[model samples]
Target: MDRFESLAERRIREAMERGDFDDLPLAGQPLDFSDVDDPQWWIKRWMEREQIDTAALAPMVIQLRREADGFPDALRRFDREDDVRAYLEDYNHRVKQDRVESRFSRESRIIAPVVDVEVTVVRWRELG
Candidate 1:
C-alpha cells in the first residue's frame, strides 16, 4: 500500500512539474461554495438548473418561513392597506393552524411562528 501511495504521489508531482494541470477548468479560481454548511447544495444546484420548484419538497414550516422572509417583497403587489392586512392575517392564521397540527403530529417537530400583522402592515406601508 505504501509503495503504491508513493508511486501515485511521484506521478502527480511529475505531472504538476510538466504543467499537465495548468489548463484545467477553474484552475486558479475560488470555488463557488464559501462554506460547507449545507450538505444538499448539489441537489439544490441541480434543482435550480432543471427549473424545479424545490420549495415543494420542503416541510410546511420551512415553506411558511420562506414566505415570511419574502413577505416584504410580496407586499409590493398590494396597493391597499386593507389588502395587506388581510393577507398578513391569512398568513398568520395558517401559521397558527400549522402550529396546532404540528404539536399533534409525530412527523413534524418544527412549528413556524405567526407573523405580527400590525408590524408587517407598517413595513408594507414603508415599502410603498
Candidate 2:
C-alpha cells in the first residue's frame, strides 16, 4: 500500500490495540439499510433522515418528463376517449416541436409510448 495509507492503517491498529475503538456506536454490527442500492444513495439516505422533499428541488425539465411519462395515469380522471386523444395529441405536438438546446428531438418523442395517446390511454386505463 501507499505510504499515507500504510501510516493511517498503522494508526488505526495502534488505536485498536489501545482499546480506543471499543464501545463505539453500532460496533460489530452490519449496517441496516431500509432502502435499495442507488447511485445517489447518500442523497436518499440524507433525505430520509431529514424528511426532505427531493422532488421540490428537481429541475423543471425532469419534472416535466415525469408528468409526461405518467400522462396516461393522470388522464384516468377523464372518462371520455375524445378527451384522452386530444390530450395525447397536444402533448405529442408539444414534445415534437420543443427545441431545448436540441436535447429533445422529434425522433425521441416519436419513439416514446407516452406520446401514443390513443393506445396508451385506453390500454393503461383498461389494465387498471
The best candidate in terms of lDDT: 1
lDDT by candidate, in order shown: 0.85, 0.68
Model 2, runs deviating above 4 Å: 1-61, 99-114
Q: Put down candidate 2 lDDT per residue, 1-128, tens digits, no spaces.
A: 35667877988888999999999988999986755566778887888889998887864445556768776678887787778788778776655444343365433432322366657776767855
Global lDDT of model 1: 0.85
When summed lDDT is taken over every stretch of 10 residues in candidate 2, the lowest stretch is 105-114
After superposition, which runs of candidate 1 have C-alpha atoms over 4 Å from their true positions? Answer: 1-51
RMSD of each: 8.2, 9.4
TM-score, every prediction: 0.57, 0.39
Please give the clash total of every predicted structure, in order: 0, 0
Model 1 over residues 19-99: C-alpha lDDT tens digits?
999889878987887435789888878888799996788888899988998977899999999999999988999888888
**Worst 10 contiguous positions by lDDT, candidate 1:** 1-10
Query: After best superposition, candidate 1 residue 10: deviation in angstroms?
Result: 55
Q: What lDDT score is found at residue 89 in candidate 1?
A: 88
